[model samples]
Each structure stands twice: as C-alpha cells, then as structure tokens.
Target: MEHEEEEDRLSNLPKIILHNILSRLPKKDGARTSVLSKAWEETWYTFPILYFSDGLFVGTFPQPWEGFLRKRKNFIDYVKRTLLRFYDNGLAIKQFKLSVNNFELHYMSKDVDHWLKLASECGVELLELCLPDGPDQDEEGRGECYVLPNGVIEVKSLTELVLMGGIRVDTAFMNHSIKFFSLKVLSLWAVLSRDEHAIEHLISCCPLIEHITLKCCSVLIPNVATNFLLESDTSGVMKSLNMHGLLKLKTVDVQGIQEVYIDAPCLEKFCYCPGDFDAPFKIDFDRCQNLKYLDLLSLKSSIITDKWFLELFSKFPFLESLKLNNCRMFERINISSVQLKVLELSNCSNLKEVNIDAPNLLSCVFYGGGGSEPIISFLRSSSQLEVDLQIPIDYLDLCNLRESLQNIKPQNVLSSLSLFIFQPTEDALNPLVFQVSSPPPSIKHLHLRSVPKNEILFSSVVNIILSSCCPATISLSFNPFFCTKAFIEFLYETLMERKEDGCFCGSGDTRCWWHGLKDVKVTSSMKIDENVDFKTMLELLGFGEEISFTLEV
Candidate 1:
C-alpha cells in the first residue's frame, strides 16, 4: 500500500512542476525527503536543483565567534556526508550554487568536488560559486581561491555563473561545455592573472550570455573602457545570451564595466557604474520593453540630452523613481513622471533647466542652485510641497514667491520651508528691503546664516525682521572667509550688550521678539579656528545656558 501510494504521487506531478518543487529544497533536505514515501525516494535522486551553502553547516554547530577558526575534522565529515548523499541520489540539477566561507576553506574543497561531480553528470544548468566579499578592502586583491575538482569537468546544462569577493577564478575553471548561459555577474577586486586572451576565450565560448557585471573588474585586452562604439559596436553582442535568445536579455550591473550592448526586448533594470569618470558606457534602451529603473552613478563620461534621457524613460511602462548625480555636462532635464513621488537634484553643477510635470511629486530640493529664485519659481507650480530652499543671502529672489502661496489650491497645506539668506555685501541691502516688505506669514523655521559677520552692524536689519516675522529657530554660520580677529572683537562686544538687553537683534520689545526664537546655533567648518567667536556667538544667542553645536549644510 505504501509503495503504491508513493508511485501514484510521483506519476501525478508533471516533470516541470516536479522540477520546481524539488528546486526549492536544499540539497541535503531534498535528498532526505526520499524517506517520506517511496515516490519521493527516486524523485530526490533525479531532482534538478542542487544548492550547497557552507554557512548552513557553520551555523548548525554554533559557538561564540572568535577570530580563531579551528580545522575541525567533524565539520569536514558533516559536509562530506551531505555531498556524498546527493551524489548517491544521482539528481540531474538545473541549478548548482556553492557558497564558500572562511571557516570551511580547509575542507570545503572535498565536499565541493563531490557535489560538482554529481551536478556535472546530471547536467547542471546554472552554476554559481560565491566567495566572501573580502576583495573590496584589499588593494592587492589578495584573498582565498577555490579549485574545481577533476571529476567536475563536464556540465552540459550550465547557464548563469557568478564569482564574487575572494573567489580565485582562473581560465581553466570557465572552459566548461555550457552554452545557454543567459547571465554572468562578477565583482572582481583582484585577478590572479590579467590574461585578456583567456578572458576573451571564456566570453567568446559562451555566446548565449546576455547580462554581465564586473564591479572593479580589470580585464579585456583592449580594456572594456576602449570598447565604446560611437553609435553601436558592429561587434556589439550579448556575451551571455544565445543569439536566438538575444532579445530575452533583462539587466546588467557592472563596476569598471565600461560599455555594454543593450539590444534586448525583455531587458529591465540596467545599473552600470564605472568608478573612473574618463571612461563611460552608452546604452540604447529603445527596444527594451520592460526597462524600469536606470541608476547610473560613478559614470565617468557621456554626452547627455533630454531626448536621450526621455528615450530611456520611455522603455518602462511603470517607472516612477529616477536619480541622477555625479554626472557633469548633462543639463536641462524636463521631468514628467506620471507616478513619481520624489525628485532630488544635487551637485550637478551644469544642471540648468528643470521643467517638471510630476503632479504626484510631494517633495523637491533645489540643492544645486543656492539662489532662491529658480527653486521658488519651480515650487510655484507645486500646490503644497515640503521644500528646502537654501538660498544664500547675496542673490535671493523671493519677489513673486512670497505671495504665490495664496494661489495654492488649499492655502499652506505644505508644512515647512527653510530659507537661508546672507547680507554681507552692500548690494545685499536692496534684497534686505525686499525681505522686510513681505515677511512669510507661515515661516515656521527661519535660519539666518552669517547674518552678523565681519563686525557688520545688523542693528537696522535686525529691527525690521523683529517687527515683521516670528521665527522658530535661527542658525548662524560664522564662515572662515569672514572669521577675522577684528571681526571677533566687535562681535564679542556687541553680543554682550545684546544678551544683556534680552534680544539678539537690538529692538526686541515687539510681538516679533528674538526672545521667542527657541534654538540658536553657531558653528563653522571643522578646519576653522573659531574657539573665541563660537563661544561668544552662543552666549549672544542665549544658548550659552545650554551649549549647542550647529552646522549649516
């Protein structure tokens, strides 16, 4: 009866369904499940997925982690048993994953050999070996290496393979007879040999490759950096995907992976970052039907335009978020995201135009331009947006901005606006007059950076602000440029008098009293030696009662 029931269960499942179910099981667990019933007995043996995790056995017998790792024969025995059991079961594997760690380096090779032998015989499709990510810290890229066993020579079904961290991958290990490999992602910090010919042999052999990632990888005879074709490389090819399966490519993420060929239909998320700027890759995403996210940072060079960016965005049917940074010469971005939530633009010095139509955008930052005019104009179209308009004092243009708030559909639903204005120059006098004319009524937090610097008399300017708007917090950046000995002496003298009168600005007996402003911060660049000025600035702001370190970012 038990024997008949097992046979019935095995016969009921279709081959593909049986393959998927068995794929989820860990190699050890899958093999052991054969004892459950007679149907599973042979099923585990012929299962198509073989997963080997060295971490699993390490965790099974846990002790306090010491820097010292012992060579335990028992540990080796445990892993050997698992590998032999899988080999004995004789399952044809669809995917073989081997993860090696520091603790198992001594004995993992033995167990690894057994696992590969079984996988090769059964035709493993996806072979992956992950070593610890130690390559990042070492300049020489020195770390442990794995040697494949002699019995593991033939794997006719291998497809995707990844070697990361300290995995010592040489030419011979890659010369397997596997074709339909759709992807190969490698993060190589160190190469045992920079043999470009060997690398080429490996890639050329796998014509089915579509996606490849080599973070900080240094290979390719002519250097991958030299592989950029002005329009498209006539030799442009998917190294990992079959030509028959070229359009089936999806995504490629690389480091030092300079240029990539994107002639795929199903390609989705493409993240390519070259740490050095002089060398950059150009991708054509026109045919990619499902492309969603494009994160290109640490990209060294590329001529950028709205048309090129728009062409990239058009590929994704449901893309919502996009971030661009560290890219120079790419100016004028007109954004129109149907479902974008946040748009952040920073440090793109050449970024000039921002024409956005993202109605769903809830937050915006004009961190690039310090003058208040462009950002305020940008937000004028936004109904109620939480904004950080940090405009430096000299060129602030809030002329139409102060009154535009009334036009928002629901007046002032937006929470807060942080404004930074400097008034060190005589030309700053005109904008100072403009500020007092229409002080923001909903101004929640007012940050005054470098307002009282170089012994500059802020007496009149202080009175106008005190009578106009009430601020929650006032911050000061006593910059190094104006932090002189003569400036400090006058500032110290004025601060003592101001504090005695219970106000930062001279006239404070009105509703807009400086006394009401709760937090007052005084800070400078860490390199600046402002020990006397910083101490006295805090005293003047009434923060001497409770010292506070403030930095204007």
Candidate 2:
C-alpha cells in the first residue's frame, strides 16, 4: 500500500512535464535525478537544455597550479560525459551554455571545440560561451583564446548566439561571406577577430538578425592620452562593431568602442558608449525615421559640443527617451524635444546646468558629483510628472535647490518623489536647519537615503520637508554602522512627541510648526536588542496599524 501511494503521488507526472522540469535544473542535478525512478532516468536523459559553469563545479582556485589543473580536468570531464550521454541516447538539445572563469584557454581549447561541434550536430537552438575578461590582456594576442570552429557558426538551427571574452573566428572562415540561417539575436563581449570588417560582413550576412550588442570589445592602448584620437591599424582588424547594411536591425548597443562608423537605417533604438579614446564616431541616422530611443554613456572627454547635442535632438523628432551618463565636455545641456517623455542624467562631472522644455515629459532623474550643483529647469508644465534626484550633500545650496524644485511645478497629485543625500562631509551641517523653499505638496511616496553618521542632519531635513509636504508613504535607507543602538529609539521619541502634541511653535513665532504624522516606517540593517521591543513601544505611544519595520541583512 505504501509503494502504491508513493508511485501515485510522486511519479504520476506526464513524461513531457517531467522532461521540462529536468531541463530547467542544472546539468548535474538533472543527472542525479535519475536515481528517483526508471521513469525519471528516461526523462533526465531526454532533457533538452544543459548549462555548465566552472564556478558552480569548483570554488575559486587557490595558488597551486596543480590544483587548478586538476579542477579544470574535472570540469572538462563533466561536460564531456553529459554531452556524450545525450548523444548516445540520440536526444536533441535545445540550448547549451558554458561559462568558465580563471581557466587556461590554451589547454581547454580542443575540448571546447569538440563540445561546440557536438552541440551543433545535436541541432541546438541557442548557444552561449563566456570566459574571463581582463584589461591587462597581452597586446600581442598571446593570451589564451578560442578560435570558434566553422560547424558552430554554420549550424542551420541556431537561433541565438552569444560569445564573450577572448573569442575569435578562424581566419579561414573570413575568406568567404558567412551567414547564420536562423540567427535573430547576436551579442558579443570583448570578442577579438582578425578583421574589423568581419563583424560588418557577418551582420550583412544575417538576413534575419534584429538585435545586436557589442560591449567592451575595443582594444586599448596602454599609455595613450584620451584627448587625441588613436589611429586604426587597417593591416589587422580590431575588436569593434561596424554597423553597415543592417536593414532589419531594430536595436544596437555599441559599448566602449574606440572607433565606430554606423549606418543603420531601420534602427528603432540606439546606444553608444565611447571608450577612453577620443576617436571620431560617424552615425548616419537619416533613414532612422522610426527611431524612438537614444542613450549615450561614458563618453569621457567627448569632442561633441552643445551644438551637436541640439542637432541630434532636432534630427530625431520622434525620439521619446534620452539618457546621458558620464559624457564629459559639456557645461550646459539644453534640450527642447516636443515628443520626449523621459530624460535621465548621471555622473556628468562637468555639467553645470540643464534646461529641458519637453511638454510631454513624464519623468526625469538627475545625479552627479559635488563640484557644482546643476540648475535643472522644465519650461513647460507636466501634469503627470515625477522626478528622482540624487545630489551631493554638500553641493546642495538651499536657495538653489528650492529654485530648482519650483521650476518643475508638480501637479497636486504628484506621481512620486525620491531624494537621496550622498557623500556627507563635515561641512554639510549648519547651526540651523534650512526650510524647503517650495515643499512638494501631495507627494505619493517619499524616500530618504543617508548614512548613519549624518543622522542628525538627515532627521532635521526630513522634519523641515514633512512640515511642508504630506506624503502617503515614507521610505528610509538606514545604515547602522553608527546608529544601530539608538536609531529606532530616536524615531520613537520624535514620533511620540509629535503625536502627543499636535504641532510645535515658538513662544512669539507663529511660523514655527509641525505635522500630526500618523504613519512611521523603519528599515535598518540590523536589529538592536530584544529589550527594546518595537511593538510594545509603539503600543505605549498609542499608535497602531500604521507602522512598518524591516531588518535587512
């Protein structure tokens, strides 16, 4: 009776469902499930997905070279055995992923080639291979690399391909145009090829490819200044993506490219992250009428002036989202997009001011360093606007921050408001707390983030702001390095005093006041002690049902 019940309850799932359940598990775990029953053994053997990571099988390799060699052999043997078992069973694999870190590619190259060829012959649909990435790689290309075999590229059933870290294609395959008959998405990260034109040729050959991401694939010059452009070596191909003749490409992300010349007409979205070199980039967007998003990041020491930035906005009348991050060389950014809805800026160290007149804008985020506070203005009123700002604690001038807040002119039903005070210095505190010039009214949710050392200033600022705006929910990011013992006690005392007496006022000053705040939230990184019972303290204070406490590890 016990055996019958076990079979009915645990082993009754259908074969297809069992196979799917095993497919999602790790390769080792899936193989171990064969000990469950005969039905599970058959299901494990037929599972269609295999993912292997050296980190999962072995911990960080220590100093001894022999230890590394032993672990590397074990990793290789595990993959070989898994693939061999599937091949012997005549089972088709839908996807194969292999990620190795801190492994000598020179010794494992042959094994990798064999595994890829086996996966290709099994009609795999998706293949991903990732290796370690390092900027200190040998310039003369003496480091270990995988020269991908032709079988993997010529696989007729592969629909997605992702290659990362020290990957290259055989020079023999570059002689003729190569195409992936079924590939729709291709991503390359730190991939090296013999010819820069090979990437362009490959994109041209992929008739169905739509999305491409090339991340950190540029080769660096060791002691070169970033202000001047580096000359390209046409004799040898560099690791950069050249977007030409890609008619169907909808999205393109070129990250850390030394030199790029792009002409993708049908692109709907584009992102460019220029590397340290100040090389020239030519992007022809004349035919990208459908383009709606453009992102630029880490363009340090850029030669593009404010005039070019304005021209870019003018060129794409339909652009809806624009994000700029750490793109130096501009002091003032003025954007007037009729259709723009979202704008974000972060870590633009040289930026001093921004004037945006987007009538349709709905949200904006601004974050930067402490050199000088940038003046942000929204010329047109956005009825449904929300803004998130992260500013340096000392860089904030009370008058300027008030002016900037008034510039937005948020509606009565504000979408949201988030303020984070970062990099608190000794100069941040003043004798008297400054009042918010134009306190946001009717904030839906308010978040305040600060370190424990600046708790006094953070609390004083929160008090002044809450005196103006009445937000429905308040969130706090509390670090407990200093205030672990007395943080909750401080909140409890403040809230109880405010609750007992409706508001506070000076003897002869009518302007001094406070609010009857009912809701309180406390999130800390550690719990202090059981003696300080939070629930009992709140109960004694006569507050109920509106308090929340979270302890984060």
lDDT per residue for candidate 2 within 256-349, as digits (tens), equals 6666666667788888876555555444555677788988887665554678768877777788998888867577777887898988887787
Instruction: Give me the runs in candidate 1 sitting further than 4 Å from their true place.
Output: 1-72, 91-97, 103-111, 119-127, 132-144, 147-160, 168-177, 181-212, 220-245, 277-290, 300-321, 329-333, 336-353, 359-553
Local accuracy of candidate 1 as per-residue lDDT tens digits, 1-553: 9987776876578767765776777666767777866556666655656555556655544575552244344455654565566566764556767666646453355566665676666666677766653322233432234544433324445566655544434456565564334334322333322243434345445555566555654432322567531111112111221112355445566545445555566666666555554534555555566666666665445455777557545656555556555555355666666656555554555665556666666765544344323322342345655544443433233333343332222334334333343444554554233333433344454444434343444443444343333444333344444323343344334433445353433233333243344443445434344555755544343211222232121
Provide the TM-score for each candidate, comma-separated: 0.48, 0.78
Candidate 2 ranges beyond 4 A from true positions: 1-37, 60-68, 134-142, 219-241, 301-310, 329-334, 349-353, 395-404, 410-432, 435-442, 452-470, 478-489, 499-513, 521-553
Candidate 2 steric clashes: 0
* TM-score for candidate 1, residues paired by index: 0.48
**Candidate 1 C-alpha RMSD relative to the actual structure:** 13.9
Clashes of 1: 18
lDDT for 362 (candidate 2): 89
Which number leads on lDDT?
Answer: 2
